[model samples]
Target: MKRPTLSKKIDQLIYRNHKSATTNVIGCLVLHAIRSEIFERFQRAYVGMANKESSELGNLPTSPMAERARTCETTGERLRNRELAYGFDLDYKNDPPTLVPCTWSKNYAIGLYGRIGLQCYNLQNGTNLKFKRLEKHSTKRTGRYSSVYITLDATDPATGSVCSFQTQFSNAGSHLRLRARITWLTFAARIKQIPNEPIDDDWDEDTPGINEFYKVPLPKWFSDERGSKKYYVPESELHDNDWLQLLMEVAFFSKANRRLDAYLPLELNSVVVETLEDEPRDKLKADNAIFYISYKCCADPCSTPLAGDHRAVVRKTMDGKPGHMCLEVAFTKEQNKNEEE
Candidate 1:
């Protein structure tokens, strides 16, 4: 008779470890967490070695991965991202937290965290940064709390570039949850501050000055002619377009951590308003006019949403960075939220 397979053995362990409560879910989450955690550590060593290697590298090692790891290898840092990703285990287990693509990226935990950290950087330094993306990340876990480090790409928005930044906070509970008690979060910032411009401190980010706000002229990414200057876009730029699509991507992510009652995509209500429909024309008259589309959303995928979710996106083109957006569904009389308390 053949012995039990590794899958079966782990299944047995789960039933015993978790007392058979949501064993399947727990097992899957454990798999993703371990996979991401292990892969992260492995990639770091590989890349460090790869960069130092003289000969050009080819396909990476894939023969026989080991069951027992080395002491020297595991000794340094352990993001324990699996723990960081624990919250997302339920809904968005498909997309775990890790490094991701640049400015304007969203949908996954990596992108979401990058933007959130960037916003913190902006608030502290009076400088407005337009460029962003995750270049590198490392984390240290102790008990239920973990310290995260990011080599962020905070470029200039006008030339379309990168900037590096980080920030820290002290709280007790989990970092993902705002209720953390007393923890130390250290964020490193190496961003070249945007010059000659003041931040949009009012409800409307109206800043007028000499700006490098040129149309994105990248060869394949070049956009065509004009629409109304007041944040207006025609049908071409509205539906099925990259400009509008990126805006909507965050609509779902913005609320990812919030609690909700409506079923996703089905009960998820969305209706596009004509761009600049009610925006003041005076603001668009500036020669330094930059364009972007903004929308609303909540965040969720593999885990339960947090207490906060509803959010309005800010469209900042001149600087290569994103700013704060106050969120609330539009209505005359106050309406009861479809989300649960």
Candidate 2:
């Protein structure tokens, strides 16, 4: 007779583990505690890293030596960011100031900052519009979808002005248009700082050195017979073991213990209103303004309108719900009808 397979064995273990009501509750609680403890540690580590990265360099006097040193250090010190404008220090005052080709740059990592909102006004038309939140239907288990959306809105009298808000170039070069200026904050993932360099030469064969890294004590909930395998624990409730393992491995090999890093996409902070100008698009005669407002994430699929399993689609529906949102597959019977026709 063949022995039981690994999957079957795991299933048996799970069933056995949850067989008793008391044991199941105890196991979940223990697992939850372990996860929470580990997450606190990870967060502390990340905070440490972030604090280290945001450190200000020693004040060096302005001189040729300093300039030359900066140039030399830039190769490693400065981040190789493609969407440099996505940082806190950007100047969008000048129209279309050197945008990063409207693409997501991998040099930066997107993280949870908070919700963002937008508003615009057209002085010429005496109208204004407000944006509604259109966030992804996220759950603790799914982590969080990096992208967020706002439903385009306007005052009742200003309704007609927002009709073409979704279309590109619909508001370009319009008379006395006012738009808000906002900054985007993203973290440079590739950039790492070693606050203190390790002395590799000092470690001898007899010395434990970096090789003697301490392992985090995992709770008894980790055992195969201790917890349910079918249910997934959310990151907020428990630190993801895989992520923790990766961090541990990196710290061990790089000798960067206690070093933490995080992406603080607080770059989108500036909120200013600016007047518009009539450009070539508007000069073309009869049509909507040649220039429309556009918002870019600058952290996703590196192309126009960051691509993902969920795409940002602006649709006018008669549902009569203001800023109502949902996820569904895009399909229509028109395709079949067209084929038959």
> Roughly what TM-score does model 1 have, to 2 decimal places?
0.27
For TM-score, the strongest prediction is: 1
Per-residue lDDT of model 1, residues 172-288, tens digit only: 232222211112222323342322122232222343422323222211111344343333455554554422343344344333422233324311122223222232343422223
For lDDT, the strongest prediction is 1
* lDDT (0 to 1) per candidate: 0.36, 0.25
* TM-score against native, each model: 0.27, 0.17
* Residue lDDT tens for model 2, 1-341: 99997546655655566775555777756655666686789767765554444443345344454454445556654454332322122223335533223222222111111111111112123233332222221111111222221112222344543331210001011111111111121111111123311111111223332121111111212224532221222334223222222222221211111122432111111111111223223221111111111122233555322222211111111111111111111111232244347
Count of backbone clashes, every candidate in sequence: 38, 11
Give the range where candidate 2 is weakest over 10 consecutive residues by summed lDDT: 167-176
Q: What's model 2's lDDT at 324?
A: 19
